[model samples]
Target: DTVSYGRIFKADKQTRIASVGIGYADGVPRALSNRLIVKINNKKYHQIGRICMDQLMIEINDENPIAIGDEVILIDPNESKDLTLEDWAKLTNTITDEIICQFTTRLKRIEI
Candidate 1:
C-alpha cells in the first residue's frame, strides 16, 4: 500500500484498481475481503476492499510490477513469505477446502 492508493481510493478511478477480466464468483465469501495480496514481479498489492462474487479489485502502484495479461502469483505455496488459501480460511473463518474450491471453470490450471 502507498500514498497514491490512499489518494485514489478517495477519488475512485477505473485507472487506479488493478483487476482481471476474470476472477472468482462461485460462492466466494466477502469476508476474504482485502486479505488476498497478490505478488507480481516482486511487488505486492492488496486486492481492494471486499471481493465481489464475480470480480475482485487489486491496487497497482506507480512502481508497477506487471502489465495487462502479464502472469502473476495469486499466492505462492513455496515462497518463504507466501500467502495461502489457508490465510483466506483464517480471515473468513472457514475451512481450507472451501477456499480452495472457490475457483470457477474460468481458471486454467498450471502445475506448479
Candidate 2:
C-alpha cells in the first residue's frame, strides 16, 4: 500500500480504533499496508497505516462494543461476517494459496 492509503487518519465517535498485535513479520503483506480489512465482533473495519513488523491498526465502530483482548477475525470462512483469505489475496493481488503459505510460526491457528 502507498503512503496515501493512510495519509489522513481520523476516527469519529462512532469508530473505535484498534492496534492489532500482528504484522508483516507474521506474514501480513506490506502490500496490504493500509488497504486491508479485519473483522471484529462480526463487523468489518478498515486497516489503517503502513503494516508494521509487529502490528497494524483497525478502525472499528464504537457501536460494535470492542475491548482489549477481544478475539479479532483475520481470515475466516464466515463469508457473511469475517474477512476471508480471499479478501487479503485480492488486496495483495495474490492467490489464496500463496497467502496461506505466507503465514509464519508467530501466529497460532485456532478454529472456532
Candidate 3:
C-alpha cells in the first residue's frame, strides 16, 4: 500500500509503515521527507513519502521488532554524526541555528 499524503512511497512488497508522532509542524522539514533517516533501536530507517503536518511514515520490515512505544531518534549527535543538526542544515540548505529554531513547542524537549 502507498503511504503519506501524496502517496510518494510504495513498498515493493507487503511491509509495515510506522507513523511517527512528529512531522512538519514539529519542525521537521518537508524537504526532508524522503531524505531523512531516523534511528530506532540503533537501526536506521528512511522517512518515506511527503511529510505530513503532524506525523511522518517510515518503512519497516516484517522482521523488525519495533513496537508502538519504541523510541525513534530524528537527530542524535551521539549515535551518528550524520544525524546531527548540522547535517540536517546541510541537507536543507540552511543554518544549524535556523534548523534548531524552527522546531515548535509541540515537541517535548529533553535535556540530557
Candidate that scores best on lDDT = 3
For candidate 1, give the lDDT of residue 40.
72
Choose 1 or 2, whichever is better by lDDT.
Answer: 2
TM-score for all predictions? Answer: 0.69, 0.77, 0.91
What tens digits encode model 1's per-residue C-alpha lDDT throughout 51-104?
Answer: 665666777756565678776676677655436767667777888898777767
Residue pairs in collision within model 2: none
Ranking by TM-score: 3, 2, 1
| Regions of candidate 3 where Cα sits further than 4 Å from its true position | none
- RMSD of candidate 3 to the truth, in angstroms, is 1.4
Model 1 error, position 45 (Å):
0.6
Each prediction's Cα lDDT score? 0.63, 0.76, 0.88
Clashes in model 1: which pairs? 25-53
Q: How many backbone clashes does candidate 1 have?
A: 1
Report the C-alpha lDDT of model 2 over 46-105, residue by residue, as the tens digit: 887778788888866556688899887777785843377877888788898998888999
Instruction: Put down candidate 3 lDDT per residue, 1-112, tens digits, no spaces.
Output: 7888878787788787899999899999998889998999888898889999999998887576999899999998786556889889998999999998989999887898
Query: In angstroms, how far off is 23's CA in candidate 2?
Result: 0.5
In order of lDDT, best first, we have 3, 2, 1
